[model samples]
Target: MTTIVLGAGAVGTATAWYLRKSGHDVVLIERQPEAAMETSWGNGGIIHASEVEPWSQPGMPTKIIKWLGKENAPLLLRYRAIPHIMRWGIEFARNCTPERFRENAKSNLHLALHSLKSLQEIGAEAGIDYDRATRGVLKIYRSRDSLDSAQRSTDYLAQHGLLYERADPDRCVELEPALKDTKSTLAGALYFARDEVGDSNKFAQGLAAACAARGVQCRFGETIEKIETRSGRVQAVVTSKGRIVADTVVVALGSFTAPMLAKNGIRVPIYPVKGVSITFKRAAWNAAPTMPLIDDSKLFGFVPIGDRIRISGSAEITGYDMTPAPARVAAIIANASFTFPELKRYFDISKSKVWAGLRPVSPTGTPIIGETRIRGLWINAGHGHLGWTLSCGSGRVIADLIDGRDPGIPVPPPQGVVVARAA
Candidate 1:
């Protein structure tokens, strides 16, 4: 069967790779000249399966209310004229129940772990390098209250077969000495030794190259104007270049997918949650920490990618503004300096480049995957903050469904009628 995967980010590229491996002729389409040029570009880089919890869990409503319009809040919701954002936000609150949180976390963990295995397999098979490191990820806390909250989350994870070790302030320093500067303010931490980190853009581009090598046609720089259908199934995709026919099509267009699908009468309920990242040249390699670490108090994570250091965090709920906000950029730099003061000189604040990307977030915090109401149309999107971590597994699942084979993971029942492009 011939298939076209939309969006050339990690998810779309991985989907094309797996589809080709599954004996299908695949073509990938992306608007950017390069793959992973958007959300996959400058992520925190932590592939943490154990940390698969929804952002909308119980206490989130109060927090969201408090943080609305706050420049440095962990989650910011900025809005204007869109009803989808409000709709998604309301449903997000609905899913904050304890029951939904546990269920969603379990499902997310399964996908995350499976994706890590798939990622390693792809790395070995394609011999594609993304500056990956298995040095583990640590979530550091500065307040006792924050540490206690982490303990609860960790206990929940432990109940579901994920193990995380509790680390004292000294142990945290031992694990990541670069954090010694913040040791005095740290209350405690949690270490997930199985977790890893890497460059999302490098991974996507590498996989795209591997796909090309495997005879998968990648149509980069192609703007998809619309998706056309016949007899209630996808017939062809209309693009600026031309109309491309396909037996099946998977929409993985990230933030843009929602509106595009909505135009076709499909309400995906995926909203764009903007995030920022700052990548700097490692001026002090010896002093820098090898392990990826998250400062929970500051809501940011520092990921070491070869000679460069990526400090990324801050979820801004502004709709579709990809431009970097100076305030947010400054916050990331200031937060990094607080944690690793030894490398303060290495971090040239003036030279720090700011990048912002939108995360396609769904209400349930789990991606919408499976055959939609539209016969030949499928969806494998809305992985949100975990897109890079869950991409490979999602691709495998979508490929399985396309092949009429049972997805190894339990198929989530269609939550509701998945509307298609209106006539």
Candidate 2:
């Protein structure tokens, strides 16, 4: 059977790669001239399985309300987006309970760990070198309360194969020498020994090339107009150029996944959450962390992607807008300056690249991946901020399903109108 995977971001590219690897004839389509030119192009580029907790955790509502309207706030809800997101917001609110929060975290962690393993396998198979690093992810906390809460979360995840070490201020500097300047300002840090980092854009591009070598049709510069359905099954994908008869379709369009399927009267609870990143050329090193670091107190992090430093963090409920707000970019820089005092000396604002991309977020913080009510149609979307982190595993599972084989790992049920496991 011929399978068509839509969009060429990391998620879609990974899906196509796995489909072809599993002995299926696949056609990869993208609106752009090439792959990874959208959200996957400008991410923080960290594959962080350590950061598996969802945003909709207990007591998060009050934090969101408190941070409203602040430009530098970690979570921003644009007033204009409130009405459009009312239904999703209600679901988000309902999932704030301790039970739901733990369940969602477990679901995300399962796939994230699987994705991490799958990523290494793909890299070995494809010989991809996206400036890979395995120094682990350091999440620093500024307050005792925050550190304690994260410790509790880590303890739960520890039972599920997450290896982490509690680092004091001195130990943190030993882990990442860049923090040597501000050791006194830190309460403590959680160093996740299992997490890794890399440039996601390069991963998508490299994997796409491998897919082409494997005889998967790479059709670029064609936009999807609609999915022609016949008797509750996908018939052909109508694109700008022409139609291709497809036996199956996997919708991996990221934030655009929901709207595209909605045109076919299928409602997936995927919505766009905007995030921004600023990449700077690393000057002959004054103080840049070699390891990936996320500040729990400040809600931002910077990682070394090759010789470049990329600082990214922020959750804005902006609807489908990919414009990089200058203030937001500046705020990211300012937030990093506090953590790394010498970062300003090396960061050249004029030479930096600022980018914004919409993350396809679901209310439960668990990606919706399964076979939908419509036969011959499948979904691998709603990965949220972990799109890069979840891509490889999601793709492998979906492809396994299409091949009528076991996925080897538990997958989250596809939310909304989805009625069956992908198998």
Candidate 3:
């Protein structure tokens, strides 16, 4: 079977790599000159299942209201420019119900845990190194109320096979002595020992190389023009370079998957949620922190990749534009400085590069995976904020669907009609 995969980000590359391993002729298409030159680049590289809570949780609605006009709000909605942002806001609020939160958390935990194991196995088999670290993830809180709330959510995740422990402020400083001087800012913390971190861009590039070595045709710098179908199955995918005939097509185009399908009359309710991150060159550490750090109060996180530190967070519902906002960058810097002051000397402030990527977000925050209404076409997008964390398992599940094998995990029901569109 020949499979055409759209987009060459982490998800797309992983899909191609696994599909090729499944004994299929895989051709990966990308709009960029190289794989992972888009959203998969400059990402917070923490692979965590325990930190898999949806953003639309109980305490978010009121907080969003308070943050509306604030310039540095962790999750900002630029309401002036995007009126449709309100619709997403309404839908997001609807999912904040206790029942929905619990359901989404459980569902995400399933994918995150499975994906972590799959990622480890794939990396070992391919002998791919992405500066990997298994020092776990520590989420620190700065307020008592916030710390208490996180405890409940962490407990919920831990109950569903995500092992986590509540760490006292002193314990947090002990885990990462870098936090010793900042002890006054800490209220408490939660540590997930199974969580790991690495460079997502490096991982994607490594996997792409592995796939090519396995006879997968990774077609970079090619744009997918359209998907031609008859009898409810994809026949061939038309691209700017040429027509790619395939027995199956997997729409792993990240945030663009929903819009591309909508053109073909598929009503996939996926939206682009903008996110930002900055990478700093590492100099030296008296002792490098062996863990990823998340500041709950500020809603931002920093992950170590060898010597460099990557800081990322913020979700703005501002459509397809890739414009970088200075205010958002400032907020990220503010949060990062508070978490790790030593980064100031190591990274040149003026020389630092800022980047923003649109996350393919679904209303429920859980990725829409499985067979779609269109035969021979499957979707593995909408992982949104958890794309890097969830890609490995999603690739395996998507390949299973293509191979007509039972996906070990329970698959979600098919979504409604999907309209396909040209890029």
lDDT of 2 by residue, 282-351 (tens): 8776566898999888788788889998999888988999998787888888889999988877778788
Task: Report the candidate with higher lDDT, 1 versus 2.
Answer: 2
lDDT of 3 by residue, 61-149 (tens): 89877778777887776677457656666777888899998888788888888899899999999998898999899999888888898
Clashes of each: 6, 0, 15
Worst-scoring 10-residue span by lDDT in model 2: 414-423
Candidate 1 lDDT by residue in tens digits, 1-423: 778899999999999988998998888999999999989998888888856897869889899888777777788766462454777778888989999988888888878878888999999999988998998889999899989987997798777667789999999989988777778999989999889888889999999999999899999999999888877898888998999999889999988888888867888878888898888888656778888988888888888887788888888887888998888887777887788887667777677767889989888888888766778788888888999999998898788877877666655334463532321
Candidate 1 vs. true structure, TM-score: 0.95
Give each model a TM-score: 0.95, 0.98, 0.94
Off by over 4 Å in 2: none
Q: Give all candidates' CA lDDT scores.
A: 0.84, 0.89, 0.81
Candidate 2 lDDT score relative to the true structure: 0.89
Candidate 2 backbone overlaps, count: 0
Cα deviation of 368, candidate 2, in Å: 1.0
